[model samples]
Target: MGLAIGWTDAGIARLLLPGDTPADMRQRLGQAGGSEKHDGQPELAARIAAYSEGARDSFRDITLDLDGVPEMNRRIYRHIRELEWGETTTYGAIARWLGDVAMSRAVGAAMGANPIPLIVPCHRVLAADGRTGGFSSPRGVRAKMEMLALEKAASPNGQFSFGF
Candidate 1:
Protein backbone atom coordinates (compact mmCIF):
# COMPACT_ATOMS: atom_id res chain seq x y z
CA MET A 1 0.00 0.00 0.00
CA GLY A 2 1.08 3.62 -0.61
CA LEU A 3 1.23 6.28 2.12
CA ALA A 4 0.07 9.76 3.22
CA ILE A 5 -3.00 11.29 4.79
CA GLY A 6 -5.36 14.18 4.11
CA TRP A 7 -7.25 16.60 6.28
CA THR A 8 -9.82 19.11 5.16
CA ASP A 9 -7.81 22.15 4.31
CA ALA A 10 -9.92 24.79 2.61
CA GLY A 11 -12.52 22.14 1.75
CA ILE A 12 -10.30 20.47 -0.84
CA ALA A 13 -8.91 17.70 1.35
CA ARG A 14 -5.22 17.60 0.56
CA LEU A 15 -3.39 14.27 0.62
CA LEU A 16 0.38 13.74 0.75
CA LEU A 17 0.64 10.02 0.18
CA PRO A 18 3.60 8.27 -1.43
CA GLY A 19 4.55 4.65 -2.18
CA ASP A 20 4.71 1.95 0.51
CA THR A 21 7.71 0.94 2.51
CA PRO A 22 8.55 -1.25 5.49
CA ALA A 23 8.59 1.72 7.86
CA ASP A 24 5.57 3.40 9.37
CA MET A 25 4.72 6.10 6.84
CA ARG A 26 2.36 8.02 9.05
CA GLN A 27 4.96 8.28 11.76
CA ARG A 28 7.43 9.57 9.24
CA LEU A 29 5.12 12.41 8.30
CA GLY A 30 5.00 13.48 11.90
CA GLN A 31 8.76 13.54 11.81
CA ALA A 32 9.23 15.31 8.48
CA GLY A 33 10.37 18.48 10.30
CA GLY A 34 8.21 20.78 8.21
CA SER A 35 4.68 22.13 8.20
CA GLU A 36 2.88 25.03 6.59
CA LYS A 37 -0.25 26.94 7.51
CA HIS A 38 -2.99 26.40 5.01
CA ASP A 39 -4.71 29.59 3.94
CA GLY A 40 -7.96 27.64 4.26
CA GLN A 41 -9.80 24.84 2.54
CA PRO A 42 -10.96 27.02 -0.32
CA GLU A 43 -7.43 27.90 -1.25
CA LEU A 44 -6.45 24.28 -1.12
CA ALA A 45 -9.42 23.34 -3.24
CA ALA A 46 -8.45 26.02 -5.68
CA ARG A 47 -5.00 24.57 -5.86
CA ILE A 48 -6.41 21.15 -6.55
CA ALA A 49 -8.60 22.70 -9.18
CA ALA A 50 -5.64 24.41 -10.76
CA TYR A 51 -3.68 21.17 -10.73
CA SER A 52 -6.50 19.38 -12.48
CA GLU A 53 -6.86 22.28 -14.87
CA GLY A 54 -3.33 21.67 -16.15
CA ALA A 55 -1.23 23.56 -13.61
CA ARG A 56 1.89 21.50 -12.97
CA ASP A 57 3.59 23.86 -10.55
CA SER A 58 0.30 24.32 -8.75
CA PHE A 59 1.36 22.26 -5.80
CA ARG A 60 2.32 22.82 -2.18
CA ASP A 61 5.50 21.60 -0.59
CA ILE A 62 3.45 20.31 2.32
CA THR A 63 2.26 17.50 0.06
CA LEU A 64 5.37 15.62 1.08
CA ASP A 65 3.79 14.94 4.43
CA LEU A 66 2.46 11.47 3.91
CA ASP A 67 1.18 10.20 7.21
CA GLY A 68 -0.24 6.87 6.09
CA VAL A 69 2.22 5.24 3.72
CA PRO A 70 4.38 2.16 3.91
CA GLU A 71 8.17 2.13 3.88
CA MET A 72 8.54 1.38 0.20
CA ASN A 73 6.21 4.22 -0.68
CA ARG A 74 8.22 6.59 1.49
CA ARG A 75 11.43 5.46 -0.10
CA ILE A 76 10.09 6.01 -3.58
CA TYR A 77 8.56 9.39 -2.77
CA ARG A 78 11.70 10.56 -1.02
CA HIS A 79 13.61 9.78 -4.14
CA ILE A 80 11.08 11.62 -6.26
CA ARG A 81 11.33 14.77 -4.14
CA GLU A 82 14.98 14.80 -5.03
CA LEU A 83 14.01 15.70 -8.57
CA GLU A 84 15.35 19.18 -9.36
CA TRP A 85 12.33 20.20 -11.35
CA GLY A 86 12.26 20.15 -15.17
CA GLU A 87 13.75 16.68 -15.15
CA THR A 88 12.55 13.08 -15.04
CA THR A 89 13.57 9.56 -14.14
CA THR A 90 12.29 6.12 -15.06
CA TYR A 91 10.71 3.46 -12.89
CA GLY A 92 13.52 1.12 -13.83
CA ALA A 93 16.02 3.82 -12.98
CA ILE A 94 14.33 4.38 -9.65
CA ALA A 95 14.35 0.69 -8.92
CA ARG A 96 18.02 0.64 -9.67
CA TRP A 97 18.57 3.68 -7.48
CA LEU A 98 16.95 1.87 -4.60
CA GLY A 99 19.14 -1.13 -5.34
CA ASP A 100 15.99 -2.98 -6.28
CA VAL A 101 17.17 -3.71 -9.80
CA ALA A 102 14.68 -6.56 -9.96
CA MET A 103 11.86 -4.47 -8.59
CA SER A 104 10.88 -2.29 -11.53
CA ARG A 105 7.35 -3.56 -11.28
CA ALA A 106 7.42 -2.84 -7.60
CA VAL A 107 8.58 0.65 -8.40
CA GLY A 108 5.69 0.99 -10.85
CA ALA A 109 3.38 -0.39 -8.22
CA ALA A 110 4.69 2.09 -5.69
CA MET A 111 4.11 4.92 -8.14
CA GLY A 112 0.60 3.67 -8.79
CA ALA A 113 0.07 3.65 -5.07
CA ASN A 114 1.22 7.25 -4.64
CA PRO A 115 -1.41 9.26 -2.84
CA ILE A 116 -0.18 12.82 -3.25
CA PRO A 117 0.36 12.50 -6.98
CA LEU A 118 1.55 15.84 -8.35
CA ILE A 119 3.22 17.00 -5.19
CA VAL A 120 5.33 13.90 -5.03
CA PRO A 121 5.85 14.33 -8.73
CA CYS A 122 5.01 10.75 -9.66
CA HIS A 123 4.37 11.98 -13.18
CA ARG A 124 8.11 12.58 -13.41
CA VAL A 125 8.62 8.86 -13.39
CA LEU A 126 8.32 7.56 -16.91
CA ALA A 127 8.59 4.25 -18.72
CA ALA A 128 11.97 2.75 -19.60
CA ASP A 129 11.45 3.41 -23.28
CA GLY A 130 10.68 7.11 -22.66
CA ARG A 131 6.97 6.47 -22.53
CA THR A 132 4.82 7.92 -19.77
CA GLY A 133 3.33 5.05 -17.86
CA GLY A 134 0.09 4.77 -15.94
CA PHE A 135 -1.00 7.35 -13.35
CA SER A 136 -3.30 5.43 -11.01
CA SER A 137 -5.01 8.28 -9.24
CA PRO A 138 -7.45 10.85 -10.47
CA ARG A 139 -6.67 13.63 -12.96
CA GLY A 140 -5.81 13.00 -16.62
CA VAL A 141 -2.79 10.92 -17.66
CA ARG A 142 -2.13 13.33 -20.52
CA ALA A 143 -1.70 16.03 -17.92
CA LYS A 144 1.11 13.99 -16.49
CA MET A 145 2.74 14.01 -19.90
CA GLU A 146 2.20 17.71 -20.09
CA MET A 147 3.84 18.21 -16.73
CA LEU A 148 6.87 16.29 -17.92
CA ALA A 149 6.90 18.44 -21.01
CA LEU A 150 6.82 21.56 -18.89
CA GLU A 151 9.69 20.33 -16.82
CA LYS A 152 11.63 19.31 -19.90
CA ALA A 153 11.17 22.71 -21.46
CA ALA A 154 12.28 24.44 -18.27
CA SER A 155 15.25 22.17 -17.61
CA PRO A 156 18.72 23.22 -18.70
CA ASN A 157 19.29 19.81 -20.27
CA GLY A 158 16.87 20.61 -23.11
CA GLN A 159 15.89 17.08 -22.22
CA PHE A 160 15.23 15.51 -18.83
CA SER A 161 17.82 13.19 -17.36
CA PHE A 162 17.07 10.04 -15.43
CA GLY A 163 20.60 10.10 -13.91
CA PHE A 164 20.91 6.50 -15.06
Candidate 2:
Protein backbone atom coordinates (compact mmCIF):
# COMPACT_ATOMS: atom_id res chain seq x y z
CA MET A 1 0.00 0.00 0.00
CA GLY A 2 1.11 3.58 -0.49
CA LEU A 3 2.34 5.55 2.50
CA ALA A 4 -0.69 6.81 4.46
CA ILE A 5 0.10 10.19 5.91
CA GLY A 6 -1.88 12.71 8.02
CA TRP A 7 -1.32 15.60 10.40
CA THR A 8 -2.21 16.61 13.97
CA ASP A 9 -3.60 19.99 14.88
CA ALA A 10 -1.87 21.22 18.02
CA GLY A 11 -4.60 23.79 18.28
CA ILE A 12 -7.19 21.01 18.61
CA ALA A 13 -5.50 17.57 18.75
CA ARG A 14 -6.83 15.13 16.17
CA LEU A 15 -5.62 13.36 13.03
CA LEU A 16 -7.36 13.76 9.70
CA LEU A 17 -6.80 14.01 5.96
CA PRO A 18 -6.22 17.52 4.72
CA GLY A 19 -8.59 17.13 1.82
CA ASP A 20 -10.01 13.70 2.43
CA THR A 21 -8.54 12.74 -0.90
CA PRO A 22 -6.52 9.54 -1.07
CA ALA A 23 -5.38 10.31 -4.62
CA ASP A 24 -3.82 13.53 -3.41
CA MET A 25 -1.89 11.58 -0.79
CA ARG A 26 -0.49 9.19 -3.40
CA GLN A 27 0.52 12.06 -5.63
CA ARG A 28 2.42 13.89 -2.86
CA LEU A 29 4.16 10.98 -1.19
CA GLY A 30 4.41 8.94 -4.35
CA GLN A 31 7.80 10.45 -5.22
CA ALA A 32 8.66 12.74 -2.34
CA GLY A 33 12.19 13.49 -1.13
CA GLY A 34 14.01 15.16 1.78
CA SER A 35 12.54 17.35 4.55
CA GLU A 36 13.82 20.61 3.05
CA LYS A 37 10.51 21.69 1.49
CA HIS A 38 8.64 20.34 4.49
CA ASP A 39 10.36 22.68 6.94
CA GLY A 40 8.23 25.62 5.82
CA GLN A 41 5.78 24.65 3.12
CA PRO A 42 2.40 25.98 4.37
CA GLU A 43 0.64 22.81 5.44
CA LEU A 44 3.96 21.14 6.17
CA ALA A 45 5.08 23.86 8.53
CA ALA A 46 1.77 23.81 10.37
CA ARG A 47 1.99 20.09 11.01
CA ILE A 48 5.57 20.28 12.24
CA ALA A 49 4.86 23.17 14.56
CA ALA A 50 1.69 21.53 15.86
CA TYR A 51 3.61 18.49 17.06
CA SER A 52 6.48 20.63 18.34
CA GLU A 53 4.12 22.61 20.52
CA GLY A 54 3.11 19.44 22.33
CA ALA A 55 -0.51 20.48 22.33
CA ARG A 56 -3.25 17.99 23.14
CA ASP A 57 -5.42 18.74 20.12
CA SER A 58 -2.64 18.11 17.63
CA PHE A 59 -4.41 15.75 15.29
CA ARG A 60 -7.95 16.94 15.83
CA ASP A 61 -7.80 17.56 12.08
CA ILE A 62 -5.03 18.21 9.55
CA THR A 63 -3.60 17.26 6.18
CA LEU A 64 -0.92 14.63 5.65
CA ASP A 65 1.73 14.75 2.93
CA LEU A 66 3.14 11.25 2.75
CA ASP A 67 4.88 10.34 -0.47
CA GLY A 68 8.14 8.39 -0.79
CA VAL A 69 9.34 5.91 1.76
CA PRO A 70 11.50 2.80 1.38
CA GLU A 71 9.79 -0.50 2.12
CA MET A 72 12.01 -1.49 5.03
CA ASN A 73 11.76 1.79 6.88
CA ARG A 74 8.09 2.02 5.99
CA ARG A 75 7.41 -1.20 7.85
CA ILE A 76 8.89 0.28 11.01
CA TYR A 77 7.84 3.90 10.51
CA ARG A 78 4.18 3.26 9.74
CA HIS A 79 3.73 2.00 13.28
CA ILE A 80 5.89 4.74 14.72
CA ARG A 81 3.76 7.35 13.00
CA GLU A 82 0.73 6.24 14.96
CA LEU A 83 2.30 7.17 18.25
CA GLU A 84 0.10 9.82 19.84
CA TRP A 85 1.41 13.37 20.12
CA GLY A 86 2.19 13.31 23.84
CA GLU A 87 2.81 9.64 24.33
CA THR A 88 6.07 7.83 23.80
CA THR A 89 7.33 4.27 23.49
CA THR A 90 10.92 3.13 23.92
CA TYR A 91 13.15 1.82 21.14
CA GLY A 92 12.98 -1.53 22.87
CA ALA A 93 9.22 -1.17 23.00
CA ILE A 94 8.91 -0.47 19.29
CA ALA A 95 11.07 -3.48 18.43
CA ARG A 96 8.88 -5.78 20.46
CA TRP A 97 5.83 -4.25 18.85
CA LEU A 98 7.31 -5.25 15.50
CA GLY A 99 7.24 -8.84 16.77
CA ASP A 100 11.03 -8.92 16.72
CA VAL A 101 13.56 -9.56 19.45
CA ALA A 102 16.98 -7.89 19.82
CA MET A 103 16.01 -5.22 17.35
CA SER A 104 15.79 -2.29 19.74
CA ARG A 105 18.90 -0.78 18.23
CA ALA A 106 17.41 -1.41 14.85
CA VAL A 107 14.30 0.40 16.00
CA GLY A 108 16.47 3.33 17.04
CA ALA A 109 18.03 3.27 13.63
CA ALA A 110 14.59 3.27 12.08
CA MET A 111 13.56 6.27 14.13
CA GLY A 112 16.63 8.14 12.98
CA ALA A 113 15.86 7.21 9.41
CA ASN A 114 12.51 8.97 9.48
CA PRO A 115 12.50 11.75 6.87
CA ILE A 116 9.59 13.42 8.59
CA PRO A 117 10.60 13.71 12.24
CA LEU A 118 7.94 16.07 13.59
CA ILE A 119 5.27 14.41 11.51
CA VAL A 120 6.31 10.85 12.37
CA PRO A 121 7.22 12.05 15.84
CA CYS A 122 10.52 10.23 16.37
CA HIS A 123 11.11 12.73 19.15
CA ARG A 124 8.46 11.01 21.22
CA VAL A 125 10.72 8.01 21.67
CA LEU A 126 13.41 8.05 24.31
CA ALA A 127 16.48 6.28 25.68
CA ALA A 128 15.78 3.82 28.48
CA ASP A 129 17.45 6.30 30.81
CA GLY A 130 14.45 8.60 30.22
CA ARG A 131 16.59 11.06 28.35
CA THR A 132 15.39 12.70 25.19
CA GLY A 133 16.40 10.43 22.35
CA GLY A 134 18.22 11.36 19.18
CA PHE A 135 16.47 13.13 16.29
CA SER A 136 17.63 13.56 12.67
CA SER A 137 16.83 17.26 12.58
CA PRO A 138 19.68 19.77 12.73
CA ARG A 139 18.49 20.84 16.21
CA GLY A 140 19.95 17.59 17.58
CA VAL A 141 19.30 16.91 21.28
CA ARG A 142 18.03 20.42 21.70
CA ALA A 143 15.09 19.57 19.50
CA LYS A 144 14.58 16.31 21.34
CA MET A 145 14.52 17.99 24.73
CA GLU A 146 12.04 20.61 23.65
CA MET A 147 9.74 18.05 22.08
CA LEU A 148 9.72 15.93 25.21
CA ALA A 149 8.76 18.91 27.30
CA LEU A 150 6.05 19.85 24.86
CA GLU A 151 4.46 16.42 24.97
CA LYS A 152 4.91 15.99 28.70
CA ALA A 153 2.56 18.87 29.23
CA ALA A 154 -0.21 17.55 27.01
CA SER A 155 0.27 13.82 26.67
CA PRO A 156 -2.69 11.51 26.82
CA ASN A 157 -0.23 8.68 27.54
CA GLY A 158 1.40 10.59 30.38
CA GLN A 159 3.58 7.56 31.12
CA PHE A 160 6.80 8.90 29.66
CA SER A 161 9.50 10.40 31.80
CA PHE A 162 12.43 12.53 30.64
CA GLY A 163 15.48 13.45 32.72
CA PHE A 164 15.75 16.76 30.85
Candidate 3:
Protein backbone atom coordinates (compact mmCIF):
# COMPACT_ATOMS: atom_id res chain seq x y z
CA MET A 1 0.00 0.00 0.00
CA GLY A 2 1.26 3.44 -0.89
CA LEU A 3 0.07 6.88 0.17
CA ALA A 4 1.06 10.02 -1.68
CA ILE A 5 -0.04 13.52 -0.72
CA GLY A 6 0.03 16.75 -2.64
CA TRP A 7 0.14 20.24 -1.17
CA THR A 8 -0.55 23.74 -2.41
CA ASP A 9 -0.42 27.25 -0.95
CA ALA A 10 -3.99 26.91 0.29
CA GLY A 11 -3.50 23.55 1.98
CA ILE A 12 -3.38 19.94 0.73
CA ALA A 13 -3.88 20.06 -3.01
CA ARG A 14 -5.01 16.48 -3.13
CA LEU A 15 -4.46 12.98 -1.84
CA LEU A 16 -3.11 11.07 -4.80
CA LEU A 17 -4.56 7.67 -5.52
CA PRO A 18 -3.44 5.29 -2.80
CA GLY A 19 -2.02 2.81 -5.26
CA ASP A 20 0.25 5.29 -7.00
CA THR A 21 3.94 4.54 -6.74
CA PRO A 22 6.09 7.35 -5.38
CA ALA A 23 7.38 7.84 -8.91
CA ASP A 24 3.85 8.07 -10.22
CA MET A 25 2.99 10.70 -7.65
CA ARG A 26 6.15 12.65 -8.39
CA GLN A 27 5.37 12.64 -12.08
CA ARG A 28 1.90 13.90 -11.35
CA LEU A 29 3.44 16.75 -9.41
CA GLY A 30 5.93 17.47 -12.25
CA GLN A 31 8.76 16.72 -9.86
CA ALA A 32 9.58 13.18 -10.85
CA GLY A 33 13.34 13.52 -10.38
CA GLY A 34 13.23 15.99 -7.50
CA SER A 35 12.90 15.80 -3.75
CA GLU A 36 9.53 14.86 -2.25
CA LYS A 37 9.73 17.62 0.30
CA HIS A 38 8.17 20.93 -0.59
CA ASP A 39 9.20 24.35 0.74
CA GLY A 40 6.74 24.48 3.68
CA GLN A 41 4.23 21.66 3.90
CA PRO A 42 5.51 19.81 6.92
CA GLU A 43 2.19 20.45 8.63
CA LEU A 44 0.29 18.57 5.92
CA ALA A 45 2.65 15.60 6.17
CA ALA A 46 2.35 15.66 9.94
CA ARG A 47 -1.46 15.60 9.64
CA ILE A 48 -1.28 12.46 7.50
CA ALA A 49 0.92 10.81 10.10
CA ALA A 50 -1.45 11.84 12.87
CA TYR A 51 -4.41 10.30 11.08
CA SER A 52 -2.53 7.05 10.55
CA GLU A 53 -1.64 6.93 14.23
CA GLY A 54 -5.31 7.56 15.15
CA ALA A 55 -4.11 10.48 17.23
CA ARG A 56 -6.07 13.05 15.30
CA ASP A 57 -9.10 13.83 13.19
CA SER A 58 -6.92 15.76 10.82
CA PHE A 59 -9.60 16.13 8.18
CA ARG A 60 -11.67 18.16 10.58
CA ASP A 61 -9.21 20.98 10.35
CA ILE A 62 -7.44 20.65 7.03
CA THR A 63 -8.41 22.85 4.10
CA LEU A 64 -8.77 20.86 0.90
CA ASP A 65 -8.30 22.42 -2.50
CA LEU A 66 -11.01 20.69 -4.48
CA ASP A 67 -11.11 23.06 -7.37
CA GLY A 68 -12.71 20.94 -10.06
CA VAL A 69 -14.91 18.56 -8.16
CA PRO A 70 -18.47 18.43 -9.52
CA GLU A 71 -21.17 20.15 -7.52
CA MET A 72 -23.21 17.01 -6.86
CA ASN A 73 -20.12 15.07 -5.95
CA ARG A 74 -19.02 17.91 -3.74
CA ARG A 75 -22.38 17.78 -1.99
CA ILE A 76 -21.95 14.06 -1.43
CA TYR A 77 -18.46 14.68 -0.10
CA ARG A 78 -19.72 17.30 2.34
CA HIS A 79 -22.21 14.81 3.70
CA ILE A 80 -19.54 12.16 3.96
CA ARG A 81 -17.34 14.54 5.87
CA GLU A 82 -20.17 14.95 8.35
CA LEU A 83 -20.04 11.23 9.07
CA GLU A 84 -18.60 10.28 12.39
CA TRP A 85 -15.18 8.68 12.34
CA GLY A 86 -16.41 5.31 13.52
CA GLU A 87 -20.13 5.30 12.82
CA THR A 88 -21.02 3.93 9.43
CA THR A 89 -23.88 5.08 7.24
CA THR A 90 -25.26 3.72 4.00
CA TYR A 91 -25.03 5.21 0.54
CA GLY A 92 -28.80 5.04 0.32
CA ALA A 93 -29.04 7.01 3.52
CA ILE A 94 -26.82 9.68 2.08
CA ALA A 95 -28.85 9.76 -1.08
CA ARG A 96 -31.93 10.20 1.03
CA TRP A 97 -30.28 13.04 2.83
CA LEU A 98 -29.72 14.62 -0.55
CA GLY A 99 -33.50 14.32 -0.96
CA ASP A 100 -33.31 11.64 -3.58
CA VAL A 101 -33.34 7.92 -2.89
CA ALA A 102 -32.42 7.33 -6.52
CA MET A 103 -29.02 8.82 -6.03
CA SER A 104 -27.57 6.02 -3.93
CA ARG A 105 -25.62 4.50 -6.78
CA ALA A 106 -24.48 7.94 -7.78
CA VAL A 107 -23.30 8.51 -4.25
CA GLY A 108 -21.36 5.27 -4.42
CA ALA A 109 -19.85 6.25 -7.71
CA ALA A 110 -18.92 9.64 -6.33
CA MET A 111 -17.17 7.90 -3.48
CA GLY A 112 -15.30 5.63 -5.88
CA ALA A 113 -14.14 8.72 -7.74
CA ASN A 114 -13.20 10.65 -4.62
CA PRO A 115 -9.80 12.30 -5.06
CA ILE A 116 -9.16 12.71 -1.34
CA PRO A 117 -10.08 9.50 0.41
CA LEU A 118 -9.46 9.48 4.16
CA ILE A 119 -10.19 13.18 4.52
CA VAL A 120 -13.69 12.72 3.13
CA PRO A 121 -14.18 9.60 5.21
CA CYS A 122 -15.57 7.56 2.33
CA HIS A 123 -14.71 4.47 4.36
CA ARG A 124 -17.58 5.33 6.65
CA VAL A 125 -20.09 4.84 3.88
CA LEU A 126 -21.17 1.23 3.64
CA ALA A 127 -23.73 -0.72 1.65
CA ALA A 128 -27.31 -0.38 2.77
CA ASP A 129 -27.04 -3.91 4.11
CA GLY A 130 -24.28 -2.85 6.50
CA ARG A 131 -21.51 -4.66 4.64
CA THR A 132 -18.33 -2.87 3.78
CA GLY A 133 -18.79 -1.24 0.40
CA GLY A 134 -16.31 -0.47 -2.30
CA PHE A 135 -13.24 1.48 -1.22
CA SER A 136 -10.74 2.68 -3.79
CA SER A 137 -7.91 2.65 -1.29
CA PRO A 138 -4.92 0.44 -2.04
CA ARG A 139 -6.15 -2.38 0.24
CA GLY A 140 -9.77 -2.09 -0.91
CA VAL A 141 -12.47 -3.24 1.50
CA ARG A 142 -9.93 -4.54 3.96
CA ALA A 143 -8.52 -1.06 4.37
CA LYS A 144 -11.98 0.31 4.99
CA MET A 145 -12.63 -2.31 7.63
CA GLU A 146 -9.36 -1.57 9.33
CA MET A 147 -10.12 2.15 9.42
CA LEU A 148 -13.53 1.51 10.92
CA ALA A 149 -12.07 -0.77 13.52
CA LEU A 150 -9.36 1.68 14.42
CA GLU A 151 -11.85 4.50 14.90
CA LYS A 152 -14.20 2.23 16.82
CA ALA A 153 -11.42 1.23 19.18
CA ALA A 154 -10.58 4.86 19.73
CA SER A 155 -14.03 5.79 20.90
CA PRO A 156 -16.02 4.53 23.89
CA ASN A 157 -19.31 4.13 21.99
CA GLY A 158 -17.70 2.45 19.03
CA GLN A 159 -18.69 5.62 17.21
CA PHE A 160 -16.26 8.33 16.23
CA SER A 161 -15.38 10.37 19.30
CA PHE A 162 -16.67 13.50 17.63
CA GLY A 163 -19.84 11.86 16.33
CA PHE A 164 -21.73 12.42 19.54
Highest TM-score model number: 3
17-103 per-residue lDDT for model 3 (tens digits): 455677767775564122366566567667767777786473767777676678999888877787666667778889999999999
lDDT of each: 0.61, 0.55, 0.70
Candidate no. 3 TM-score = 0.78
> Could you say which candidate leads in lDDT?
3
lDDT of 1 at 92: 80
| RMSD, every candidate, angstroms | 9.7, 9.9, 5.8
Off by over 4 Å in 1: 1-5, 8-60, 153-164
lDDT of 1 by residue, 40-139 (tens): 3455555655654456553535544456568988888888877765567778889899897898999989888776666677877877666567875433
- Show where candidate 3 strays beyond 4 Å: 17-20, 27-37, 153-164
User: Model 2: how far is 74 from its true place, Å?
Assistant: 0.8
> What lDDT score goes with residue 20 in model 1?
38
Q: After best superposition, candidate 1 residue 97: deviation in angstroms?
A: 1.1
Ranking by lDDT: 3, 1, 2
